[model samples]
Target: MSPTCELADLVLPSTHWTERDYLADEVCSEWVFGQQKAVEPLYERKSDVWFWRTFGHRLSPEWWPWESDEELFDWQLEQTHAGVTWDELKEKWIHHVPMMPSRDFEENGFGTPTGRAELYSVIELVSGSKPFPEATEPKESVYATPDVAKAYPLTGVTGRRYPIYYHSAFRGIPHLREIVPEPQVVFHTSLAEELGIERDEWVWIESPTGRITMRARPSDGIDPRVCVIPHGWWQACPALGLPGYPDGSSNANTLTSDRAYNDEFLTPGLRSTLCRIVKKKEGE
Candidate 1:
């Protein structure tokens, strides 16, 4: 039997030879046994296996046969030998996978665990996590602590915009520089006035963890309780090997704490934290 079939037999012992299993087997085998010189073999194989396993059942009946595992393996080997990288192969596989079935929701009942639309989930009750269907403030809101509030008085939100030219990456592109051109730190107008900071003036946004400087854009649209910092700024200082961008300063990932992330879901709480901003002093 093929390596795919062998793996399938090992993992899914009870299931019959379905087309889903066959396709999954082939994809996994290729990822595992494909060329390693141009790319990592095991990494490629594991990723491919996951992709096929996740979406393989969505394939239509007409495309079910999968043309045999041997043929699939041979084709992958040929592609690998031709210098096609694993990333490229994975992309090809994703592009070629059959599209999901299109049908009105009324015809097909909801696919929830209870077989009905769930307003609240029993998942939390069973899993011993938060017992709610929607987001709620953590049992211990970090902002509630007096020390945390004093240290980081403003709410710091990250990932508030697109990757290209959002935070500090704008310095890398000339066109982006000509257009947006500068790092923008958004704050509530009331907060800016309270801090005695003017719009378009330099402000130092500091949290208990770290600090960075950006031009303030005080606006009424933002919540007064929160301060917004768009992600993807690369610190630009001549001394730091990046010149033209004196303030190429960011990658919110660096300042964010893994411990502050959600407990049950493990989602990063980048948007739900407090921070404080002040006017940057001259000569420093």
Candidate 2:
């Protein structure tokens, strides 16, 4: 069980990807792939649409009339007005939108108040932002706060994602865990050498908020003044005999603070925070 699931009062068993029919979209890609259901959902497990439809029927049957996923998918395709059908998608399993190498703005004009491409936005100005974009330094970065940087010299980069898993998912899978056994603090080889940290050795990455321990992994590609840590890591793989790192242990979020955030969006300054790396003592 995951840390989140452990905290929850009740957990519902949902149908896995292989047990559902769905469409997948890749970022910035023109191709849409159709996935067919491999097997019926196991006991007590239901697809997302099933849950929604069940609730909808109880609440308002008139609003949610589609009986099954096939009906819902058919209605969705009909709204596209492209004459694409569920049977066609299921047969081919892929559809590609032909991209024309021409700007739509030339034919239909830009979608703005002035109907033109704008370097300075009037909408942003009305919404209490500067007309032109400004590049400001991160609130907790080494360059922004020199005094804080003196104590925490290295730049900390968090939320490094790997291809084996999406964010913190698939960690409980034995095969995936075999590839990435535990969390790691990735830094430059030169930085690790200077700190007297050995490869695969435990090290503490400390920031103003908190500190977390991760295995040292020195890489030549990383900047000497920067260290990267992964996030979303609260799952355990029992088959591999690996213990799950609890919250605030190897979790990179422990080192970040919500105090410093983007002025416009209020996004926390976790990416470029200042931190120091130190070698952990044996059995400490």
Candidate 3:
């Protein structure tokens, strides 16, 4: 559906934000403002408003009677009953929502069934779930099988973030790669020594689900029982890496199992899986 995926029949290139105008609210519910364009649209880039308006006209012309973004903004302002007007905001570049004083809890009462916070939730009980919140073991973690643990003893904690690269993004930049050049799996030095692995050496982190090769970094910060491998590395992408690290980087999820998941949420196990790290073998 996206550019790399190449699943779409039509791919209309749009303009970046620098070439277009935008109106948005602040992080808080306090202010709404507009940002002006700095330059003309480059290449085939188009403003976001243009697409929304175009799509709206196609879906239903009556619902989108406005001819331009300005007209739409005016109509939205007309619908608001506040004392302020769009003209004032156009000059000010911001519209602030007036703050209200805190309400009296006892006199006003809460918008709850008992007019107060309930220690016990009746909704959860009615749904036939746990009445109280309690920590439970990860169903797919440690306690699965005694035999399995004998082979894959260590615990894995994946998805650690790096400051230089974001989740699969910013990797293509040369400057960022120069900062943190390789994807590494951190382990306690003691564990590495016991496993016959050395620092900076290639190692294979293996689980019943899958295995991946990455560089080993010795660190006291890492728990001996737990191994840390970062997420979002792609050997297939244009991301640069060290000489030993190839064009195809091992993504943590490739070695993660999706077979078992929470019945209620239907989520895969990205963390808390049984695994072991060892020196990379000849074939691997």
Best by TM-score: 2
Residue-level lDDT tens digits of model 2 in 1-284: 67778899988898998898886647344655678889988898888877887789779989888878778777766654435677788888887655446588888889998889999998988888888999988877777788998999988888688899998788889998899898888999998888798899988999988899989999999888898988888788889889788665988888888968987678998666789898887787
lDDT against the true structure, per candidate, is: 0.57, 0.83, 0.72
Go through the candidates in order and give the C-alpha RMSD of each one to the true structure.
Answer: 13.5, 2.9, 4.7
TM-score of each: 0.52, 0.87, 0.73
Judging by lDDT against the true structure, name the best candidate.
2
Residue 234 deviation, candidate 3, in Å?
A: 2.2
Candidate 2's C-alpha runs over 4 A off are: 25-30, 97-117
Instruction: State the displacement of the C-alpha of residue 32, model 1, in Å, after optimal TM-score superposition.
Output: 27
lDDT of 3 by residue, 1-284 (tens): 22234556777777777787676655464566766678998877778788889899889999988788777766665554334555566677777766556577669786655677666756556667665666766655667666777888887888688987767666657777777667789989899888788888889888888788788998888778888888766523244534432333366776677776764456877766778887877776
Write the candidate numbers in order of decreasing TM-score.
2, 3, 1
Q: State the lDDT of candidate 1 residue by residue for 217-263, as single tens digits.
A: 99999888777887655533333333343333544554566546666
Question: Which residue pairs does candidate 2 place in steric collision?
Answer: none
